[model samples]
Target chain A: MADISAHTPTSEIRSAYLEMTHRKRLYSGLMLAVFVALMVSGFVLADDRNAGGFWSGLHRLFDFPAEVLSEASEKLTDLPAHFVHFLPSLIETVNIAAASTLFGAMIAIVLSLLSTRGLARWPRLIPVFRRIMDITRAMPEIVVALVLIFVLGGGPVPAMIAIAFHTAGALGKLFSEVNENASLKPVEGLQSVGAGWIQRMVLGIMPQVAPNYLSYALLRFEINIRASAILGFVGAGGIGYDLKNAMSWGKGQYDEAAAIFLLLFGTIVIVDQISSALRDRLTHGARLEATL
Target chain B: MTTVTTDVITDLKGRADTLFLRKRLLGFALPAAVLVYLAYIFFAFDIPGLADRANLDNGKTLIRDSYSYKTHVTLDNRSGDITYAIEGERKGTYPDGMRPDWVSDRDGMTVVDLGRGNSVQFAQGFARIVQQDGLTVTARPDRDGVNADLPAGPLPDMISASKNRLMVTLPDARVTVTRNRVEVFKYAFGWELFFFTLDSPYHGMGFPTLLSKAVSGEAGAIWDDFWGNAMWRHADVAWALFETILMAFLGTFGAAMVALPLAFLAARNFTPLMPLRFAARRLFDFFRGVDALIWTIVLARAFGPGPLTGALAILITDTGSFGKMFSEALENVDGKQIEGIQSTGAKPVQRYRFGVIPQVTPVFLSQVLYFLESNTRSATIIGAITGGGIGLLLTQAIITQKDWEEVSYYIVLIILMVMVMDWLSGLLRRKLIKG
Candidate 1:
């Protein structure tokens, strides 16, 4: 019996290997067929002659100019023009973002309070409010701009609205989550002393989550500045408009664009540095309080 | 007993007085009223128009009728002048004998003599016939170019009637119809009219015109025209999306990359030096304080407008995020494995590679993958500011008063691209983590 078992040893391993190989081949073949079908359909249905010609022409036109500019700019300046232009737009973009973020944070606080189960009379409404938050967050800022462009007639208002709405959604969700996960000891103690919801929130929950809120708000501000730069593309005037103009012209003015971009980068770096420092202070303060 | 109870009550009242103050008559009520008023204003302010059934219907009609006109169109080319017998029986007809002189052939389309001075301009899939007087001469909108316009209202029945009858207008501004815009009742002919003439053959006016010129082998000229003149003409409205993407990517990735080393320092389990850990933690907070877009504009100004500027902006913004996230993950790592590696007389580098890395690699990869997917869309936004890619295309389409068809096309393409990136990133993340 021992000899027979030894003879059949490792048969299961071999069979499993064989089965895996067979499955792999099947899946590959299926995927290949689908890919081929797609290629064939695209070729057959597309206006290939027109599309191909147009693409080739566009490549030639844009590429040739870009090449010439790259060479000329190399000779004329020590640095690329794109570098120079990017600097200022970057700064303005930061300013817009910072303002929007602070505004968004203020709004988010009120909205979060309304959405929170702990504060609401009808706690069941929390889910409904959460769903609304989800919908707002789900939309990209671009889509928001598109919709608001129509209503607001293509101005900073649309961009501002888009940023505010998205920030509110993001911050509200974060605030609610933080509140839910917070330690209940302090809250309970306040409640036991007959403290109202507002008082408890101000004294207990806010203190615990304030640092986190500030950090998140700062992060959002950075994001909003970038978003504001693009808002110009939809006629919400910003640095993006000038950049588009430069590229479209295919002139060597990439220096201007570069300058603007550099400005944006530097501004962001400085702001980020400052924000991180502040965040460190807050967190450290929180840690000290916790230890005490 | 009564005196004792009174004293106790007095003491309780005195304690309450210290905690709460009685307000003047309307102090609290005034604030409440103001709050209510603000809420009312917010709710009452005009909300944007919803995409309701009626609005969509109106948009559809607008698109359909804008293309539904009959006119005798004459094309002027370098080879010669070619005349087309355009028959428009409906409210959307191209007028006969209309010549648009301002339309140059070099510009891809031109108008020629249709037996009179009246001109018709044909480009892309649609044709515009303007009377010498410079008013829309084909089909007058019933409500003075408001209500009865094809885009604003329903398709008029006049189109069906002029199927066979070639109504010709003299260059002298004389208009004539063969049979009063009556419907032809023959199946074969009717079918041809419905399928071939009324329906759009090319995708839209701008695309087809551009494509047609390109296919004609003037590819370079077409591209130059598109990029130089067309794109810049709407620059203010087309670069925003590009800027947005650039900012997001730079913010997310920049933060992640910078945070990598700091994360190591901040990890109590991994960091042998207590001071380094504390410093890294402090640094992480400073970086994360500001938002990403703010960084973008700042960088844009510092670097100038381009993808690099956008990237730098994103980098700074993301540094804080990645630092915090990475530090937390580091703290949560299993201490036993770290201790075991340490016991083997492994150096800090070896311990990190064999112990900490193995544990945190999955989380790090997942975060990176998520950021990449998010950044792809963000890249488009940066491109809007930096003047590159599809965002620029979208902005141009909107500003030129071009048909929404082009706008829809760009949008759908962007969405599909984003979906593909999302799917690809998700797959890579799962495979890398093997989870």
Candidate 2:
């Protein structure tokens, strides 16, 4: 009806467009300035607080790696032996990750089902379940692990429980998101057949979401491996505890540290590669099915 | 023809039956595998031994200390000096001539009212405790070991007396006496001297009176006392929390900045040189494969223990992740937009700025924001290892063993900080990506 831009004067339109562009540029420039200022100041403040200044530490950055490498190379023959010695600890670390992931994924499945819209057993309490997930997810693993370590007196069990608690919440949110995309037709069919809540979920929804859940759980396994190792550093029984022990012995025991590092790096890369390949297959299969 | 068709039908049925059998076997096998693994882990992690190692008493103490505090009324028997302190910490000691209302000095005798009809009396050389049930226990320390006198019926489990020391642990209070001194710990609820220490003029002022004083120009002094509170260290805690957030902010953005350029080289479409792309990709992998835990250790050696080290550790680890994600995003970018820009005779940089950046900015920013939220948690963990931020404070408190209240406070703060960051990031993502 009213073609305002067409009816407006060309000179006025040009000025208006220029003015808007100017304002946009001004805002963006201001934002950039603020961001830059924050970065500069934060860096300076951190450097000030740090034991070693940034400029001083910059060149020495490679020193630590070099020291470890030289020490490792000096005892090259012992490297394999060191690896063997640490293998059990490595296995224990991996086991911690695997067990935690399993327990966490199990808890996540229940939590996700209870919180997901339409799939929720008690729809009125959806928010309650969601809050529980959020709160659990918000807690850092170290916090819980340390507290448990205090009570349990430092063991793999404490680390296992801590990681599992975090994994449940983190995976629960993702699983619920996956659930929202699932079709309710199968669930309705199961309900019509007088299936119980658990039976309905098991027979109807799980088959559709199993691949995605597995993919996510595999990713979580990789992350939990890292978490378990770190928890070990804080005195949970694993390779990290060994690494810390080796590190605290100062220069002489670096070969052990080096071996542990190699083992950790190798395990992480292998696990990452395998899990990523599996995830690709899982997601790719789903996509192929969708196209069909 | 009928016979041939019957054969075909039978073959199909046989195949279906075999498939069902295999599926049924698989269903059982998977759960069986999980069960076996769990059984293995139970032994591997030594779950059975954990029961013996677990200190349920430490758990009880941690829980109890988190909610309640204890005030100690100690009498130096030799010098006849009575000093009162909360939590037995020197910082919490009452100033000279001042003590808790429950404790009073009368005629050279100090009486500690431990509430609920339980009271402890500390005189020149003896300490006496009267229980709520009217059972009185007296202990004297003179020349030799402690001499304890209790009701003859049977010594209650709460009272443990030995040759040189006597301790009576009641439900609401505790009394310990030795040759050197007599100490009575009266249990109380809430964190004592949280805002102002006993030495401060405004230590016990009511909220209304404090507010009026603040309104009347004592605000700065009041704030100073609260902020510099020795027991709570609100100022240091605030700085630590800020440092944590700063570590996250600097790390996430820094990684994004570092990764953006490298991602171009890593992207197959952007860099035609196979070797360069391979190198870039491997570099990213190397960065990522070296876990943050290891990076924190290495960087801590270079930068020493501080937030900077933690930040650098996060930055380095996330750079790898961001590089991989960014390069992937770059590879998937719609070429039509860049081609259109190119057709206008724009330079490569301009093409990227006007065409590619706009398309990928939403995804990039959203990913960065998500990492920022997650990195806040990482910062805390890193801080613990590297000695900075609330993480360091938290670990210290936990290690101290007696500062359970402080540990709880730090835990609450950390949870709030992470939740806030999560909410903030989500809000920003919605605003930027959708709007």
Candidate 3:
């Protein structure tokens, strides 16, 4: 209204806005169409390659679950015994996660510190460390685990190494992000006191970032637990190995599979709950209520 | 009053000392605990035993095979017919009367140039290795054994002679003679038959020649040969990569679409019914708690192994995650915009459309894009289980034990794929979120 003049009409502005709106709608429609086309074609291609049709398989989805449930119900008394038998394997899985997280987090702390701009010991080598992290992160755990399993034979060691390898890369990126937000005054103060690089970092940055690092490492632990289990299924040896054995036996052995599933499910839920609670404490302190 | 202040200062000092003491103790205790746990794991995981169980030779073979390939030149002692094959594979065998440029055949005599002034000559029943440093090793195969002649004070570590076999291992070539066959293996760097196999007309064509042929309208044929290369199977690998990406794309977007509406139910701000909200939340938890590994197994049972199973597994698992995150996002949306829209006589749906969505769009899109990149990796792992994508190919290549070259190729491709996806997602996230 302030810019309006005697020669310029309101109709011209309205028409211009309308044309822009029309063009936006057209582009949106085209984008939506392309998205739909891609989804539909992808679905069709996947369906074609699948052993069973999606439509046909949809109804039978519950059948396997029902069978497993029924068998477990029938063999309900054996559940406690099965749990006892598989408990050590469960502990092994948890240990794999915990150890890998510890190792990975330690490596990540060094890597993140080295890669961060202001805190870097050698500014020139930042890109090199960053590239190392990127390459490590880009590698899937299964790839390394399988290759290691070939050389080292199947065991928890391979799985542990695989998960730790990936966790370092992942946690390194997150920790560097955390490092960026930290004030450099403490580091400078420590440096002015003639403290060495390690001492400066240990005395300065760690206190500021310890909580966030713990929170992220805890989260990675949860993820690594799942990863270690999956690696076990591929012959790396854990509870998942037992589960695979139980599953491969088929039908009559469904009770064992059920027990393994319950143990895994329960462990995951418990770990998830505990870690989230711990993370909440670390991040929010006393401000956030006990939601769990 | 001074005494009271001094007492307070002493109390504060006491607390500070206690806090510092606790921190010092924790600093030591945490690493100590970690070390103890690691030591326990070392024993429990049998790390010491690993040395005994581990096969170092396999590692050597894997490392060696990844970068270099060997061409087998075998002579049948009885018939005196020589055969040249790359990696000793039928698919890489030279055609009858055709061999490498380094191998020459004239007057029933064949000499293979092993490079670095080393050569292997086969004439009649005997094979001789000629070294530039004035060392000649010859072996003649007979029914019982190989008769070996060596200019040796003591046989070097590179040469191992037995009753029925005489073997010489050098940096460039290896000659092994048994009772019935004499074989020379010439090692060369790089993946052999990567582009075109022995059957293809363009197998050994130079880049300039290939370019000229392409300019002369032979591009499609050349591409077809490369694509359909039996040794490498480039087309299958490309398709597998596409399938892996497709699984990620379809799973991520599919989960987002399915979760958005469900998220409204789960969100405390959107749904007034507590029971319904609880139900939705529990449903999401159950979906997520089952884990993608279990979901993949369950879906594979129903759908059978393919990209569909992998995609559905990712979809179901991610739906849970997206639902929780989306609902949390929905709960945190600013109510002022919705109130403004409501004051304009807008219905609930219209209010959500104009007011709520714009605020949440950036967060939701960023989350979805992040998941898209991660799901690409998950798709790879799930593909291994379900037998669909690059993971399946990688696992297959690995399991073959001897196809380390192919395994390395697939690994490089996978890493590149993941990095590209990561870059693409980051680019899209920045572009879409900001613009």
Candidate 4:
């Protein structure tokens, strides 16, 4: 047999071994520092107030309304007052969220198209658009709410506008990213056949990315729904208005608040299940196509 | 041959022309019109006024004049010569017409001499009043003087006394004077005070009163008042913020965490199982199908109200997002490394640990940190539900009719908090992921 050891250089082998050991030590030190930092930070920030005063107070404040609600239920001798109080607001909240999602998605679709780098002929415009998108996404929805509240007055309009603007920025960015990553083969083929920019996008790009776009749009809708409900707190008009009123009432309205909360929790769970199922179905179909 | 070529060219031209027309109508004109209309509406709306309509000045006057006083004085007669002194300020001369002379002491309170006729009258009240030559007056009430009442009009703009019974020059500035233990009103409008007044509400709503009385300004007092009474009183509003947070968290982490399992299935290198990979990919697509906020509304109806509702909504939506992200990360993992691990006869679990996990952990951690920061803001949106956190406070401040000061305060706080959190999280992520 040939002397394999002679063929390989001893220096190269030794250097490789040294490099591996150095890497291991460096990694170990880094991990140790990270672990120590996490522990120290957690301790430093931990709330130290007495449980009786802080936690109990919070619990009592949150639970008092539930107690009253249960009492009211007993006294009324009819349908549960908790349910009755919360049901309407819950429905309205849902409706507002749904409507906003639909509208936001519609707005996002147009914005996403404008945001696409490939669609823009001007290279300079691409970075500008990207930066604009980043800033828009960077701004918190509350800031948007504050600005819109001034323009739209104390109503759902401000909330809707805030939600819509944010959704547009976020969805636009996602859409553009999807577009960038999409298969260029079909686009090139269309271009070779003398298709224009719009033709290539519509026929080649859109077809490939449509499923992803739809999925994203649906996901945004869910987010918008939750967002719309809270918009009422800022005078944007939603179920949150009722919640604010109840909370302001303090001790007396706990039960109603709890009931409302429960309703909200329930609503989300149901929507989550439904959307998840739908998502599964859609993804499963995509997977089947990929396998073929 | 020329006829055939011309006919083919005409057909091609016709097809291109038709296609252009279709594109213009559907892609350009329609969207453009919609955009214009929407922009018009946004521009057309009137924003709320920034100014507070409440008369805070009147309340400030009440507080200043009604409660703030230094000395107590009463006069038996209006024409009596009186002398008075504050221990710390000064004591020199009083005007001849009003009072005789007064002496300063180490303590704040001082006694003054009154002229003959004024002496008896000054004795009934607390201090004797001596008319000063300049704009100053030296007034000292008798020690027994207690019944001196405030003038019925708005509180006096300024008050000062000469040191002794000699006249003294007075500045054109406003000052506060009190006698007979009555509250003195000071109308001095320093810029800091003025600004504070502007930011605060008038009467019960003003910041000074609220800060001094309601919030107490003690350590943890503001937090207690805001979180407990103010925030709890508006539970729905507070809860809404919690909901927003739940939305962001669930949307981010729920999706991200689930994405890991799905990612394994979707990753071709690891799975090698085509059906599983395809199924996982489809799963990611389905979850990522819609925007998170949309999911919130849809879920809000089904789930009802609270953080759970928001969280579930976010979770379902984010799962799709994370699934796509994680799978992409998985796909990009080095195949040779995984093959090397497999060559060692490592089980699938071990392969993931030694091969995939190490490769993806840094990316995953960074992504999680980014999402966590993003979600903090998202929580504010979901908190609009009426019961939760800062969002509720924010909305209420806006709605309670031009509580802009509070609105500004809360907005600043939230923004600062978010920025700090983002920075901290970024630092942490870098530390965690560092080689």
Q: Judging by TM-score against the true structure, name the best candidate.
A: 2
Chain A only: TM-score of every candidate? 0.68, 0.97, 0.95, 0.75
Tens-digit lDDT track for model 4 on B1-435?
Answer: 999999999999999999989976777886687577556434433222312322355334333432332221222234343332211112211223332223333233333322221211123233323323222233443343332333355533443233222111123112222333221111122211112211122212456756566555452544443444321233343453444444455456655767778777887766898888888777665554443444544444333444554555556766776777777888898878888999999998898789888889999888877877777776665555422456657766655643344455566556665666577778989788894
DockQ of predicted model 1: 0.06
Per-candidate Cα lDDT values, in order, are 0.55, 0.93, 0.92, 0.55
Write down the lDDT that model 3 would get: 0.92
| Tens-place lDDT digits, model 2, residues A1-292 | 3699789988998999999999999998999999999998998998999999888888989998999999999999999999899999999999999999999999999999999999999999999999999988989999999999999988899999999999999999999999999999999999998999999999999989998999999999999999999999999989999999999999878999999999999999999999999999999999898899
Query: In candidate 2, which residue ranges exceed 4 Å CA deviation?
Result: B105-108
Q: Give candidate 3 misplaced runs (Cα > 4 Å).
A: A5-8, A286-292, B105-108, B130-136, B150-154
Return the TM-score for each candidate structure: 0.48, 0.97, 0.96, 0.48
What DockQ do you compute for every candidate structure? 0.06, 0.84, 0.81, 0.09
Which residue pairs collide in model 3, if any? none
TM-score of 1: 0.48
lDDT by residue (B115-195, candidate 3, tens digit) is 888888887678888887868988877876788887769987888998899888888788888888889899889999999
- Please report the TM-score between candidate 2 and the true structure: 0.97
Better of 1 and 2 by TM-score: 2
What lDDT does candidate 3 reach at residue A153? 94
> DockQ-based ranking, best first?
2, 3, 4, 1
**Tens digit per residue, CA lDDT, model 1, A65-182:** 3554465566556345455545444444454465556556777776676687666535778778776665555445675576456545554556667777768877887877766766
Model 2, range B1-435, lDDT digits (tens) per residue?
Answer: 999999999999999999999999999999999999999998988889988999999999999899899988888889888888999999999999888888776777778888888888879798889988899998888769779887898788998999889999988788899989998888788988888999899999999999999999999999999999999999999999999999999999999999999999999999999999999999999999999999999998888999899989999999999999999999999999999999999999999999999999999999999999999999999999999899999999999998999999999999999999999999999998997
Which of 3 and 4 is the better model by DockQ?
Answer: 3
Ranking by TM-score: 2, 3, 4, 1
Going through the candidates in the order shown, the clash numbers are 142, 0, 0, 125
lDDT of 2: 0.93
lDDT of 1 by residue, B209-301 (tens): 766867998677554444333212323323444334434544465566568887878888668899888888767655544334434444444
